[model samples]
Target chain A: MSEIATPVQPQRAQRYGLRNYLQMYAVAARQAVIEQLQYPAANMMFMVHILIEPVIYLVVWSSVANSQGGAIGGYTAAEFAGYYIIWTLVRQFNLAIGPQGFHWRIKEGRLAAELLRPVHPLLPDLGYYLGYKIPQTIYWLPMGILLWLLFKPEINPVAWQIAAFPVVLMLAFFVRFFFMWLLGLVCFWTERVDALFELYFAAELLFSGRLVPLEVMPVWAQNVANFLPFQWTFYFPIEVLLGRLDLPEFWPGVLAQLAWIAGGYTLVRLIWKLAVKRFTAVGS
Target chain B: MLRPLKLFGLFARISILNEVQYRANFFMQVLQSSLSLGTGLIVLNVVYSYTDNLGGWSQAELLAVYGVFVLMSGLIGSLVLPNMWAFMEDVREGRLDFTLTKPEDSQVLISVRVVAIWRLVDVLLGIVVLGVAIGRMGLEASWWLAFAFAATLIMGMILLYCVLLLASILSFWFVRVWELMEMMQSIFQAGRWPVGIYPDWLRLGLTYLIPVAFAVTVPAEALTGRLTPELLAGTFVFTLVALFVTRRLWMFGLRNYSGASA
Candidate 1:
């Protein structure tokens, strides 16, 4: 027991100090990447969803466009191809849609162990999520290029468009993770989040331009989508890459995404506090 | 076969009892069913707003297809999927050995152990939608058409069950293939739209490989009277073949499982 010293005080320091906390997350994230790399086949199989979804939508939307005499919402079949291919990239980079270990943590009573740890329970998981994406993004590059070739998306994005992407994409990922994280935390207050999550996903599906481009949506729906955070996750990055956003739209969009991220951080922090008060270790 | 039904009945009763204890889950299931049906309708509405038809399917016709899709999904989710997923779990944890040792037929036992009875909400919603769509479209009703729809629908369900059983049986060798299951689901979801929308290769893959086209779309075709005799006969033959193959694979997996456990 003496040999198994618990480093409680240092953990307290690390928990309070933002720099140390972030640094620890980096280390944990690095470890997660290594662990994920060990199962290359698993990663490859998993990545198929990221690749296939866009292809499916691309095929579906293209058929609709062709049926409509080759254009809808100012996007031709080729442009749709470009949009989905770019959408795939946006999605892969901002893979915040799927439940990321948070559900399992609560369900399995692993959160009790996490709570015992000196660090905030959420950061390590969040770090692991972000870390998992690093290698996933690396693997996605060749796949993205292959899709790029196959679809032959026609947009000639400039260097600035390319450069601005990582910033926007990172914010998208951050906001999405936090948003989903807040949703996942609802498990603490409810017996099940499954149905609630379905409704949440329905909202996301319509607004995120995952099923259809918001531009093609009716004016009223498009206006409503503009105010929602869902569009910032998938549609904004892809649309921006396609040079769809005008100059006035650009700064405001980025500002909105950042504000949402800040909003998510605050909301999650509040939820976590309430959640901890309710959390019980019954199933570990 | 009678014995299998009895065994299934017992398992299903226990599951229904388990589910009914939680009244909230009943309401939740209804909400989720509505949510999914709403998602499909909204997607249909949005696409139809831009185009008159999707792959030669008008909105109401596609809505009919969606109804069958939902109905079939409920059938699978209620009985087949939860059991299969549980079977995979048992395979991973070596609890499957206990299943094999039971006096009852292990295949039947493992396949009917879990039932999400709440999925009836989806089934109810699906039939209502199908009824409304048929009424709205006025697509020439008849008893023979109903018979054809039932036959094709049963064939589709059997084929889906076979495919799911086969996939789950693979867990004997490769335990963590939940990703593959997720992939299958995404592919299965493509069945919502008419297979005609897909390119030739994809259409063939959905037809012959996953059999999703047969599982959902062909039944919809039968209901709409678009299904020909050749298609009907082909689906029947294919279902028989799949059932035979998956049954053999299940036996092989049991052998592997018991051998490893022994």
Candidate 2:
């Protein structure tokens, strides 16, 4: 039977065209949806865990606002609610599973297979990530509705701002993904990528405006956050969604996001080259 | 008991030898623990910037809470969780049969099977932090408070072990208990703060429903000289109850396993 069976031909080496990428993304998305559906309870619990962070922060800030006579640092209770609710969406969209992927690929010696792929290995990563978000949004939608009911978020964005939001959010995802992917490459050099991941999380907590608003942080921290790309990933889009950033501030934020995406892409490319060299030299 | 202690000592020695093979892991553990400590300190500093007190507790009190939290987590990671995490895998692969056939209490053997060894760094760091926090608060430690703290800490470890054992035993029934464990861990993160900080309903849930309060807050209260007679009594009762319930559950799970196979 083994001798009689003919080996299947390799699939065509398609060029990285827009249509090809879209089909790949669609297939990846379907796979993610199926995998998530297979473990519905686990996915539901994951969604609950995701919502818990935003709820905790919202409660913390709400308490702060209440203590400060229903407003703190120019944010009323309603506005704070809006800020955190939008923050949940932005965070869900921007969070990357890059470190785990990198660690697994490197440890399992599957990075070699990735290097052998005709297309950019990162493309499949991007596709799988984007695909996962489809099911995540399905999970998030009801939670979003629940938050809206409880918090009554006053998220009144202008039509144009609403249109521009997804584009900027996509840019933000790339920024986060590339930076984290670079951090993940550190596993090639050291056995301990966890320390790097921890620092990344710390920076995200402090600078990404997840714990508190950037304006509420100390001015020095705010200034540092302004220079980093972390804020653009979470805080900027959230601000835009909450209509806190007027048109002038909003466009510049988008420009800054674009700049960061370009920079992050360049950095990831350079890191990937170096990481491959180290990986090959070490024969992992 | 003495034999089990000797077995644990042998396990510790083996784990240490295994860890020594990965010399870089020591640095990783140190770096990870330091960063965790730093994050805790930073959060405390940030909260203090807003007010001297958090939820009616002083900054030093909150630090003590974190100290107990870290210490308990280290204990779990060092002994309970490392084994419980593997317990399911052992059950799935029938490797637990080997443990069952051993000339010892299977529960005792299974509970301390895999010591992470490096997690002792967190334990030591937690002790140093707890000491500093106690000194900073200028609280005088009495014999009763020390005794209460020691007892509660031990009970906290036992309670945590029981909870983990119960959670892992569920794996014998359900193959995918990992996500449930993750959810439990996420819920436990809320316990890092004082239960008082949460809304009243949440406080009730943490205290009775999840029992995370007993794991961290009871010991913290002892250290902060805030342990009431009622709270101490409750901790003791809960510890016994949790241990008894988990012991029964483990045997039930084992019987189920055998019944299904037969």
Candidate 3:
């Protein structure tokens, strides 16, 4: 019974630390990249699906601007083009695991297996969605170039704005990621999530400047956007890259994005504690 | 023709029966449609706030366009799209053998198999919007206008069916056509605005490549009293040609389809 003199006693309680989590994210991200890259055709179609939304907005807004004597709420037709073109890229960045995916995971019993893991389910999702950016950006390049050529969009970013673009873009991803994960957690409570998800997306569509730049919206709507995180995900990044924001405005936007990310992360953590407690695995 | 109609009726009844068992989905569809409609109205209002006209379309005219877009979306969603998806799935999973072996025509069988009955909520909603739009425009409904609207709408549906069927036919040769289907649907979003607003290149693509212009805009134009006789004539010819070409392609694709197994 001498514990058979364990061949090599497991190292004294190796704490699952940050380095371990980082390694886990790297592995998960790499897996996501490899998995997404294999479906070139499928990914291209998805890119087209994503691209059409912004393109419609660009076309419609550009037409409105042109029709309205070259500008509306400070965006010229060319600027609208520029905003939504870069929107294509921002969209690629901020794409996250939607609540529908969570509902699917839960209903399919995949969450049961996932709960067996030591880390939160949200961590791997963050990594996977982060890695999803790789193929998405790669697919975005040709489409971006084609859009640029087609629309002849006029984006004028200065040196610092260009440099700050990537940072804000990544921050935007974090903000959206946590919020989306938080929304996904509601699946733990109710299976009837479609109406809720639709409402969330509709809100995002209006407030996020995914439809049009916030400035172009009515003053009241723009004021409403001020309190919502939706704009940080689309409007802030696109404006930053479109060079519409000054440094002072830029810094505050970035700070607000960080604030949302922190708030979303905290909410997810608190809700997740209750959500996990309510979970009853119906499958092995 | 009568036989196909009977077959379609029988399949539609079965689909309706199957769907009624899930009554909650109807409410969900109603909520989703209303939300989208609300967002669409918001977008229109936002756009109208800045300009009285969008690409030569008055706000009321554009509302009519939006109504047609929703109506056509309901038509496709409730009738055409689900069938195409099922057909593609059957092809991918080799279940299409069951259809081909049936006594009825394969095309008719595939076309009328799945009716998403709840999606008709959008249809009713679209009609309501169209009614409001017509009231806003105060268009005197002439008998000719009514005839033209009905005629163009039927043609539009046929043209869309042909185009979508043409797309689904590719599932025979290509395993992953859902992406293509999704892309087409997104492109259809362009029809929400008058195809007139899009750049020339896109206008041509939407009109010819996808026929969304004929499907949504032309009927909308009819309702708005903007449909020219020549455009209506041209649409009629194009619809005929599309149906013929789609029929031929379906036959060709069926021959090429080896099925998932021998």
Candidate 4:
């Protein structure tokens, strides 16, 4: 018998390491930028909508604070400004997989093409979203600065508060991304996600610290909000940056975020499996 | 004009028939509208928990404003918004050629071509809310007040039509104006509150530029007995001028359409 030379095959896990994932992320991010830059005017229009809400709230909350004869929810006028300004950046970071594309794919029978691809249907969409943030971030910086200058919000954070902000924000983005993807997946079971989306949006506005700080929300509502995953998405990060949650509260907050992320990922994986089984490669 | 009117009537019937085939959509619309109206009331509740009045309107008075917002929102959702959305679709898919070839006026045909009849759910809800609000406010519904409210609401419809049509017409010259339409919606959503609460610049913009005040606030004012003769007259005049200008712009858009097709 003759000895045969054999090639050593790398393990599947080793094939895609940190570098490969980083490359994938860069490609996805770049593709997103290219797609969004095609419509500068549309991007500008979106910026107007994005900037409008926080501005409206900034004014609304400021007036509410004034009428209360000092501060409502432990936030003075300047504190409200600080909350919304940082919040503007936080929101800028939180634009996840778009509902529009999800709806369109189902409505137009284009999800079939996405499913046929070797990659997960969500990867390109995530890339597309990251690209979307580039323009949004560019627009946000100037707008945030202007809001900061205009409102002069007294947001003096300690070193760790400033440093830990981005990490918490990234977690918020993933949680939002995964949770919203679950909503998008529900399009598989029904043609009308419009009502569902509206319901989700209403709940989010109430709980996510977008409408008012969660602190000022009625005690019952705050308790309900804390039980849910949404508070981790916006309000938690915003408060963390404000140094509202001290070290003891902060560690638990981080834990809650991790728990939600783990829970969301599991839910998405399970739903995608069951949904793909039910899916007819078209609108349900 | 009579021919176009008849054509519009036919188009509206067709749209209703098409939508009625999907019976589930009606229920979904009701659910969505209720949820939307519920959110508005909840926000109001939250705000009023802290203060009695917002921007000079008491709780009941603000509810009156909300009722007007809902009513106009319903009418727009059922009529103007769907058609404008369809018009953008037409522009994109080159379906405008069919409407242009029709004997009736193109603008009339395009404008009333589709109606989501189920959205009247919001309109009826609006009336109910308004009645409750008005009843709570103890405002007299003089026959004159009724007439004035109707008149201002009609003007509001006209102004809303003008704004939506103008926004849709931009599709003739550009692509993907969905964000613009959405921008309009968010701005209009602010009308759920008294535009009075907004700053001077935003108030001015909502009143004139976006015209949400005309669509919602002014009629609300009529119900609340806050409508001044000057404001009513101005709204009427503004609607008239806007109608003429939008018509002119529509005509110009038609010319552009023809030029594009050529």
Candidate 5:
């Protein structure tokens, strides 16, 4: 009697890992850059549009400050310059492509592939999202330098404040993403999402200090902005950078951000569940 | 000219019929326009929260300016822009060839191909707002001022059409000029505020380079009893130049349309 030798079986390929995710991000960034570079004139036009807003706001606020005896609500012309420059940077960072991609995914039935992935559906989406920002960062550099040169902004900050900037900004990004994604998910219920987008934009302009600084708003409006999560998304980080908020104020803002992030995450989870349920039930 | 006018009338009627079929869109448009108007008013409220006047204009006066802006934008959105902008896309896609082959003046056909019927709501809403603002300002609307407003509004329409046509014509050379259009729009949006508030260079650009000031400022000045004869003359001259350049450019673009060597 001879024992038979058993053949060895091969293992299945491992699912995507951190390196794969990094590669996805890199690919997304490269794709974004290529897409942008393909339309040099268009990119230039967008840059000009972006440059115009800050300039308009800066002049408007500067004029306001000037008329009010060289200051309004503690913002002098130079201080206004600092605030707007920082505002511009914060805005550049907080910009997103909205839920258009999600809509596309649903329309094309590509969302199922994302759902099938072992990682969270948002990870790859976030990668693609962050990838688009790479070109934007490059585009913003020259403008930033030009703004600094023109405005000569007095944005002196403590070292700790500088260190905390990126953290606050990342939290701001998540808050915006979750909130907008939740808005996008509403499309599963209704085919049109444009009205919702406009509503969100209008609210954001007022609450996030996009049009004007929260400090300059009426005290009640400022307090309302404090309660809302939008300030955490834009104004808070810029405020931190501008040294308007001290350590005491900074910690509370961070805490508020954490609360908002938790709340946003919960809302997104609930909305995505209901959206997916509605989507599947409708058989799209 | 009569034939084109009749054709345009038919196109407008058909468009109105098409829009009526989509009753939801009409409601949505009203909602959107109201929201947009509300945003403008809110911004004004915020601005006035801190100060009574912005750039020598009171809140009511600024509202008058906004009314002019909205009214002009509505007209552009309704008539001149719809067809002109679509013509650009048609040219890019070689669809303009169909219009060119028609036994009609191509320019007239292209300029009145489609109408945005719902945009009349914006025009009506804007006029109502303007009437209210004018009443609030307590300004006398004299016959001469009304005439000035009429003339300047005509000049503004011509200037804006020229600009849109020029932008569309540029599509012959550059297929992707929509970004240029968007950039122009953003600049025009800034014109919701008076040009005086902007820096010197921007004011010059708005007044002369882009001529956005003609869209709102002249009519606003008319309503405010501040329209001068020189400004009206300047507007007329600007309109004449814009129309001439636009016509020449349209001819040039048409010649190049079929990849013809000229």
Candidate 6:
């Protein structure tokens, strides 16, 4: 019948305009907000799960700094507290759909349904994760306050730096999101990618200043980090909020983030075309 | 006790047979464990670069702690966690009814149901690291210390098993308990560092609340010459009490479970 044929043809030929894409993102993000908000207790526990990592690092580094007579690698114990407390917030913001989720999507045939949609699947994911930040931040607030009270962290961000925090925070999210998508696209090429994923995460853990400040890392590691995009996600934003980076240092970090975003976006677009061409669904 | 041991051996054999068919997983496990061990060493190296000792632990002694952490993680990963996850999934799907109907202790059956055999690579790797750390430290070797280490390691495994089993038994009341399980695991990562470095409240929590101190730290202490007689005796008592409580809770949870399918 023309009804079925017409539906297939139009879907094949149709392209979404900018306004429609924006609306799609809004809806996807709203759905994520509602879905996540429905599971508050689980999300709170998940937040605690996330928070423990930074707390461990904070405690370790604080002790080390104290043991060294109140300072090491230019960080006092209180500053270390401030850095890792901000780390908790940055962690919430930069959380993205991991490669494991992508592997599951493919294995479970969820990607088959996604392929039928006119818009890129990545767009919806971006919107969803963007929306996820809302619920995530809500969950983070009580924990953040508790950490602040418990640690008595000393952060002194100036007015302009404070104003710029949200912008950099969102940019950091984009950088990590795009890169995570790029990582996830590897699922298209191989099913046995766990080792690769592990390697990638280990590199990120070290290079991203997630484990320790880049300054505190050895010179070799700090040099390696300079050439990587990982630091822009965790280190830059935390420093911006911790009042560590000055204006001279700040603008270049922002530019680097924007540059990485553009690079990641381009890579995803190019590889996605190849990935889609290779994808063949077995069944519904 | 012998029956439970036999059951565990049979289940472990079957699990090994099932897993060995996918031999590539062993390589994957190796890669993952090595990467984590590498990162852990890097963190220790960086920390020690600034100081001679951390919480009175020399670099080699901390490496011993790291070794115990990796080893216990392997044992838990291979023996405890997979079983707990499978048991929780079974509970959720009403498969617990089948488990309950089996002609054996349900707790032992559930506890030993699954073994991720390849994860024992971590156990092997942990022993190697401990050997290197001890070699580096050059401590006086004694049978008493070795006995203490072996005893604490067994008790640590039991304490960890009891805590994890207690958490798993909660699935009868709640549909989703994996998040809580995950939170507990994250809290356990605190053991990668000695609990002595943590603040008072957290140290107390890790020691008594979750028993990660007993699980990883005390065993490491046995090797590092930090285990005192009083603390060792206290840990043993705690382990026994935990095992008793877990048995009672398992019975209670079994009663609470109504088969979703039946």
What value of lDDT does candidate 3 attain over all alpha carbons? 0.89
lDDT of 6 by residue, A74-187 (tens): 999999999999999999999999999999998877887787787779989999999999999999999999999999999999998999999999999999999999999999
TM-score for each model: 0.93, 0.91, 0.95, 0.93, 0.90, 0.97
Strongest candidate by DockQ: 6
Candidate 4 lDDT, B1-262, residue by residue in tens: 5876787789888888888899988899989999998988888888888888677788899889889989998999888898899889988888788888878777888888888899999999999999999889998769979988999999999898998899999998888889999898878887787787787877899988899988898898888888889988988899999999999999888787753344
How far residue B97's Cα lies from its native spot in candidate 4, in Å, is 1.5
Question: lDDT of candidate 4?
Answer: 0.83
Report lDDT per candidate. Answer: 0.82, 0.79, 0.89, 0.83, 0.79, 0.91
Model 3, B144-209: lDDT tens per residue?
999999999999999999989998888888777899899999999988899888889888999899
Q: Which residue ranges in model 5 land beyond 4 Å of their true spot?
A: A1-15, A99-121, A149-152, A280-284, B1-4, B259-262
* Residue-level lDDT tens digits of model 1 in A33-62: 899888776677777756777777888888
Best by lDDT: 6
lDDT of 5 at B112: 83
User: How high is the DockQ of candidate 3?
Assistant: 0.68
After TM-score superposition, the amount by which residue A60's alpha carbon in candidate 1 deviates from its true location, in angstroms, is: 1.9
* C-alpha-based local distance difference test score of model 1: 0.82
Query: Candidate 4 iRMS, in Å?
Result: 1.5
Candidates' interface RMSDs, in order?
A: 1.4, 1.6, 1.1, 1.5, 1.2, 0.8
Alpha carbon lDDT at A247, candidate 6 = 100
Give the poorly placed runs of model 3, Cα more than 4 Å off.
Answer: A1-14
Off by over 4 Å in 2: A1-16, A147-160, A281-284, B1-6, B258-262
lDDT of 3 at A101: 91
The residue-by-residue lDDT of candidate 2 on A176-257, one tens digit each, is 9888877887887886678888888888888988878888777788989987889988889888777777888887888898
Q: Return model 6's CA RMSD, one decimal.
A: 3.0
Q: Write the per-residue lDDT of candidate 3 for residues A7-116, one digit (tens) a residue.
A: 22112344688899899899999999999888899889999999989989898899888987999898888888899999999999999998999999988778877876
Q: State the displacement of the C-alpha of residue B207, model 1, in Å, after optimal TM-score superposition.
A: 1.3
Candidate 2 vs candidate 4, lDDT winner: 4
Candidate 6, clashing residue pairs?
A: none
